[model samples]
Target: MGRVGKQTIVFKNPPVISCAYSSVGPKEAAGPLSTYFDHSYEDELLGQDTWEKAESKLIENTIQGLLTRSGKNPTDIEFIFAGDLENQIVASTFGVSSFNIPYFGLYGACSTMGESLCLASMAIGGGMAQTVIAGTSSHYCAAEKQFRYPLEYAGQRTLTQQWTVTGSGYVLVTHGGKGPQVEAITPGKIVDLGISDTFNMGAAMAPAAIDTIVTHLEDTGRRPCDFDAIITGDLGNCGVDIAITLAHKLGYDLKGILNDCGKMIFDNEKQDTHSGGSGCGCSASVFTGYLYKQLLEGKLKRILLVPTGALMSPTSGFQGNTIPGIAHAVSIVMK
Candidate 1:
């Protein structure tokens, strides 16, 4: 492994994403990318006792799905790195517990998938491990209870508000595979533009996406033309527009190349999803379900996957703290 500039790591022996699986709740199953997901449950509760338990099922099932898809037993895996939006990431801890594999639970908010991928790739590329898994999950009901109003409150959502996706995505990263490889990664810095409205998280997180994307380009000496697509985690509509406008002002003109998981996960005209989908699962499911297929099918040669996050807890927001944002960029190329 070699460091590129400051924030980016250029993997000398890039790790390959051997297999991936996506499992989502009913609402996400009705979205545009329905056919891409490996499993779409009939109910949000997933036959579990509570919404939190249902959320854990998303993670558990997705990891099992990955193992099944890759034809690898639990013993073949070295470690599992994952996280979620729940307090202390119980969703992850409980989800992967039955697997009995070594694990690393993480918390990067919505950017958890990108963060996990970065560390997993480094573990392989740096010769620390040969096979591992990197993944994340999020649930609408669980997030609502933890971060906003309870389900029965029937709180009216603002137009800028985004729906937290109830889904999970997992991938098997190995030292060898013909699948997409991690070429480089740029771990982001916390950026605060002093926007505290939780409903407008897209606005709060867009600047961090811009920062990581720009820094990745500068570090690797690449241009926008270098990638077939540059995907942000959950910028949604409001945040994506801001991202394009900001990129243009910086002379980067992100028109055709820029896209977001939030924008693609659902059809806004048909679905009542306001700004679009946010949360960790929004990007995770999109990548494992849709983008992974595109890369494997050779439809997309190169892409920059930057998962953005609004780094604020309910306590922090209630205390009138400004929302801080972060984005972790992973360069995935068809090999």
Candidate 2:
């Protein structure tokens, strides 16, 4: 071949998608058929526990599930990336230890799933590794104790409150010729509505989801009908309504296609989920465990998942600042 001509080679086989997840606490603590409502620690004593214990257990269980399902050995995994909302990343640290896979820890509030997926996809695309594992977890009791107080305290919650759930979710991403390849990722664009209500995270995150979905549609030139379903993270009841209204103003009719994980997981009247969605585990578990399974079963062909997060700190609230929200989108394809 002359210098005028050049040749390129590409991998013939691509990575396959595999996921594993776990949740703690009593499956029926909230009530009959309320297994999904209660987070990991609803059955535990508040102040007497540490986030590391539960977080590690959940992560370990999730990874084990994935390994078993995919029939892959832990040693074959090239890297592991994990995170949680615990102080000093206690859960992630202990959780990754059991696998003994080389990895990095990450944090991006409730939007951890989207953030982690973005990074993992980029890593695989760049050929930095052949296989990678990414996941995030959150515990209701741990988060509540750190962010507010123990549930046993029974403190009055403000109208802007969101109930955190305890659970862990994990996904395995590998290079070409191996695992489920990442199809597409709509990088989360930061959209600030200038909202200042920390107590009401549902409202704070609603606008961000709206902004992201609109931008994603615009950028990809996709219409609402292009995808089979559009799902959101823990927006709860109030946020879901806000999302519907804003989406209507955008000229997209999502009345039937739109759903929120927070609202779908529990029966509001029976479980008393209160205001509806919360926690990293909320969307992660539902998406990976439930939705993913459905897709694999031919129930869904194309799906869009937009996970939202309210980025607020205790100091920000005390300083009279409102919570800011962010959202990221990941488009999945089965065909």
Candidate 3:
């Protein structure tokens, strides 16, 4: 691997995404891209007693489905990088440990999908691993319990608030495979614009997304028009608009190429999802399902997937601290 420019790393032997799996809740199944997912549960609980367990089940099912679709077993995967929005990422740890693969638990909040893909691709590009799985999960109920109030509380949601996606997405990446190539990655730095409203996740994360997107473009000496799409993790409606305006000010035209997983995953009016969707799974499921198919069907030649995250905990919010934001960009292309 070689450094492209500022923060981007161009892979000498770009990793290949062999297979991808997406499983979502019923609500998500009702979305525009409903037919793309591998599976969708009829209920949030997935026959589990708790919402947390349901989230864990989502992760487990994704791993199993990836292995099944790739014609591989647990032993074939060298390592699994996964995470969730739950505290300590328990959903990932408990869900993936059963497979007996080496694990690297991550917590990039909603950006965990891009973060995991970046590291997994590096593992292959660096000749350290042959096969790896990068994945993440999030559940609406589970996230609410940890980040906001329980559903039973009937907490009033602000218009800026986004609904957490109840789903999981996993990718089976390998050094040698027949699939889209992981060409490069740009890791983002923390950028806090002093926005303290935890509900307004899009606003908090837009600057970080813009920072990473522009940096990636500058690093690679590529224009926004070069990619078929520049997709952000979960900026919803509010953040995407903010990012487009901010990127224009930076001398980048992202109007036609830009879209957000948050916006793509839900219909705010129909779903009653105020801003749109937000959570680790928002981007993960969308990429694994809809975007991956778009690539495979020859609709897109190259695309940049940037998952943005709001680095905030309940404690920080309660303490009245500003929400710091981050994002990571992974460039994927079909040869």
Candidate 4:
């Protein structure tokens, strides 16, 4: 791996995404891309008593599913990098611990998907590991209760608020594989616009998404038109609009190339997901299930996947602190 610019890394030997798996809840199962997912549970609890354990089950199922799909055993995976939208990323830890694989737990809120992928690719490209599992999970009830209010409270949601997705997605990155390759990675810097409204996460994270995209383009000397699609993680309808307008003002035209996973995962109008979906699972499931399949099918030759995240803690919000935002870009190409 070699550093292309300040923020971007161009891999000398790119890692291939051998296989992927996604497990989503019933609400996501009813979404437009429902057929793409490996499994969808009608019961959000997944036979577990608590929402948190259900989320852990989602991650565990997806990881196991990825191994099964790839025709690989748990012992074959060199490392497992996973995270979730929970305190200390307990879900990922508890979910993946049984596999006995070397694990690295990550946390970037919704952007953990991209963060984990980028690191896993680096591990392969740098010869630190032959294969790695990168994944993330999130639950609607678990995240809602931890971040905002309990379901019992029946909290009122604003139009700008986004619905947390209940699901998990995992991808297997290997040194030599027949799949799309991770060509480059652009790690984002924290960009806080001093927005304190926790409910409007899309608004808080839009600028960060735009900033990271701009930096990636500049660092790689590649135009936005180069990729078949420039996809952002969990920036819902509001954030997508904001990012487009901001990019336009900054002399970047993201006309037909730009798409958002948050918006793509759900039918916002019919689903009543006010703005759209926003969670670690939002981008994870969509990319692994939908985008990866499209790449493998030769429908898309190149894609710039940028997962956006809001850096906010429940304590920080209660303390009246502004929300900081971040994003990371991973360039995937099929040859």
Per-prediction backbone clash count: 0, 15, 0, 0
lDDT of 4 by residue, 1-335 (tens): 79987789999899999899999999999999989988999999999999999999888889999998889899998999999999999999889988999999999999999999999999999999998999998999999999999999998899999999998899999998789999999988999999999989988898999999999999999999999999999889888998999999999999788999999989999999998998999999999989999999999999999999999999999899999999999999999
Pick the lDDT winner: 1
TM-score of 2: 0.86
RMSD of 2: 5.6
Task: Give the winner by lDDT: 1 or 2.
Answer: 1
The list of candidate 1 runs beyond 4 A from truth reads none
Between 1 and 4, whose lDDT is larger?
A: 1
* Worst-scoring 10-residue span by lDDT in model 4: 1-10
lDDT of 1 at 247: 87
Model 2 Cα lDDT, one tens digit per residue, 1-335:
01111111112332345554445444323433244321344544333366558667777777787777678899988888777788777788887887789978877677777777766766776677877887787777778877787768988887557667666678877765532345666656566677776657788888888887777777666787888888888888888889989999989777788787777655666666677647887777766666776676778887778878877777777887777888877766665
Positional deviation of residue 252's Cα in model 2 after best superposition, in angstroms: 2.4
Q: Candidate 3 has which clashing residue pairs, if any?
A: none
lDDT of 4 at 319: 96
**Candidate 4's error at 91, in angstroms?**
0.4
Ten residues in sequence with the least summed lDDT for candidate 3: 292-301
Error of 3 at 273 (Å): 0.6
Question: Cα lDDT for residue 124, model 3?
Answer: 92
